[model samples]
Target: MAQDYSKKPIEELMAEAKGGNIEAQNALAMLHELGLIPEASAAEAARLYAKSAKAGDPLAALYLGVMHEKGAEGVPVDKSIADSYYHMAEKGGYHKAVDRLTEAGVGRRTILLVDDSASFRNVTRALLNKCGFDVVEAPDASHAIRFLQNGGRADLVISDVEMPNMDGLEMLAIIRGRLQKKDLPVVMLTSVREVGVLKKAKMLGVQGWVLKPYDNDMLVQIVRKALVA
Candidate 1:
């Protein structure tokens, strides 16, 4: 007869965690923090979370921040520690860290409003905020991504077709692929009235397209459509 394995002990799980397995570490941390195991240890969980974060796990840093903020299970609450972990996660290219920091009142809605002309970004940001959106200005795609990585969350993205440091099409592709956002609306505002560009916008799943020298009515309509869709 095969030996019975169903009655496994808790010691095996802790051993796996101590052996440098991140998943096992996270699991044991959760079990201990939640009191599902015999010894509920928030400090132990914090240590495990720190270890995982040092190993480049953004989620671990996020959890560490949350646990520190909450002061779970006799642990001292520390907003500074939480902010540090959040910063680390943001620098690791996690976009949701921006939202987290914003919700925590430690940051703001930084919309990387990418346009070549400073006048354009300023005008667009004013208009967007008037319609209840917070905007951050970015001169190009690389700058926009940098802003995003540093805890910026633009509710909507508006980009011009022509610019240095990556064109609108390339930026759109990166946003769609790497941002991991569902129903993230993008509006392509461009001077280029070429049919090919419009067709490509459709192909790339752009929510709206507007030509340069845009009318206020057109802008409002496109923005409404982008938000609704």
Candidate 2:
């Protein structure tokens, strides 16, 4: 429930937040984010907002989404992270997030990340989160296909080229055949520099390729380019 925070002092709000009051956490976050508090800290506001958001506060989710979307004050602009937060806010019954998502033009831009390595997926997921894209992970091609067959939506696909059962190319071929949506963009990630794989990937409409040891900035640029292209 929303608290009657209009009359509450910052000190009281802080105490309440420390006591694990979700409403107070949201209120203090708003105060700090809006600079209503004396010598406010945007970082602290962001931290509180994250906490409240995790606790299922729609307002906190909305605020965090906007902050990350616009890179407000001390926050870095991360559209993918912003997208995730907006999705959470909308699911939590915040209508404003719907409008914001449309305004950002990425409300439906979900990326399917298929890989076998947990560490690679973790690192890539974090990077994609910062880029403000909603990411869904599938450990291998078969899982990715299952996700698609179950009607999960993905605007783009990033798959590791080599995996057990089905490789990225095989998965893409099967996916294309099953979905009958051949224009869907895909990027390949691989450590192997194989002429045959590259040739087939190109023939199969792979949008881009990134080697295993990718530079963060270059990866971000590649993702951005593929998304736009």
Candidate 3:
């Protein structure tokens, strides 16, 4: 059975995560990334991972890097970003990102990852970055627009279904309206298993759907296919 994380408070979550608890760490990171907790708490979660990563935690480093790249502490967003901490974790023989990077080679593919969750964004960002893709991130619709305005171009766009200020659908509409290029590949990551949502997304030209609690192999396959298509 899936662990019930909904009942755990942030402090307890942090404590458990810091105490070598992978599930707690992942859960806390997800909550921080998704804004289920106060935005300020995201920073706290990031701090927890700093310690965890030093102790050879790959997920911790991955999450921290995502938070930094996505500006979890209300910092300005910068897509071409790296986290030394994550690199340190990688150097400690954590092959999660290194393996992907090794297989992906140096030919860079640019990917834009837009989501409200700091944890999820970081984890995804790490995966893509390791896969030899240039990763850009936006917390919401407005941020995404700002990124594009500042000369961001992506081969693929991955976004969450529900978000504050602007949802993925709204962002997709804006992209279609403004970009002269009409065939950009867009994939939606959603926990909402509603058929109506999927149908609407298909109607609106969404290229793919990735369910949450994703399998890394499946994600890589979909991304590779999307980039090639």
Candidate 4:
């Protein structure tokens, strides 16, 4: 069940949020979004939603989707971007996010990240965003594919080898063979040194292989290179 935050003072909620309590963070963000507190601010709500979302809070991510969809409180009005946040929330177990989010105008290249590790996606997402790219994430290959099939956009895709539902090599094959996105750039981010898998990915036209112990700068650089190629 969600935390009961009804009786708690706003100051207590702020303190708990500051202490990294995800539920408290959402509660405080809701207050800001709803103007329930005298000092409520939509910008503050956006910040808290972003923080909690990155930490794997589904509802917070959903709120971010709403923010992006409506351009609320200085967030850009981008339906595609909103859907990206919605996908993130759905992957974290908050289903019912809008599935038919179409492509937004392609000013910034959007990268679809297919990895099961939320922490990894959250960190790399921040890094890529800092480098001027918009990043969307999925927990596995199926989710990544689902996003694409649902009118989601991606300029490049970075996927891990080991996934809970479908392995990355199989995903690459499907992307190349089934989806017929042969020209879509793909980079494998994995620690596996298995030559067979690497060869298969190469045959499938994978652009790059970045190991798990990756340099953030190098990964960003590789993604930039792939987008241009």
Local accuracy by lDDT, each model: 0.68, 0.76, 0.68, 0.76
lDDT of 3 by residue, 85-164 (tens): 44764676544443333346325878889999999999999988776788888888788867776778888889997999
lDDT of 4 by residue, 52-141 (tens): 999997777877776777565556778887788889987987654553222221246889998998999898888777766788899999
lDDT of 1: 0.68
Error of 1 at 190 (Å): 1.0
TM agreement with the true structure for every prediction: 0.49, 0.54, 0.54, 0.53
- What tens digits encode model 2's per-residue C-alpha lDDT throughout 11-102? 99999998889888876875675444678777888899899889988767776776676565578889899888888888898655646444
Q: Which model, 3 or 4, shows the larger lDDT?
A: 4
lDDT of 1 by residue, 4-62 (tens): 21222468767866888677776666556534456678788788889888888776787
Score residue 75 of candidate 4 by CA lDDT: 60
lDDT of 1 at 105: 27
Q: Lowest lDDT 10-mer window, candidate 4?
A: 98-107
lDDT of 3: 0.68
Which should have the higher TM-score, number 1 or number 4?
4
Model 1 misplaced stretches (Cα beyond 4 Å): 1-111
Error of 2 at 79 (Å): 18
lDDT computed for candidate 4: 0.76
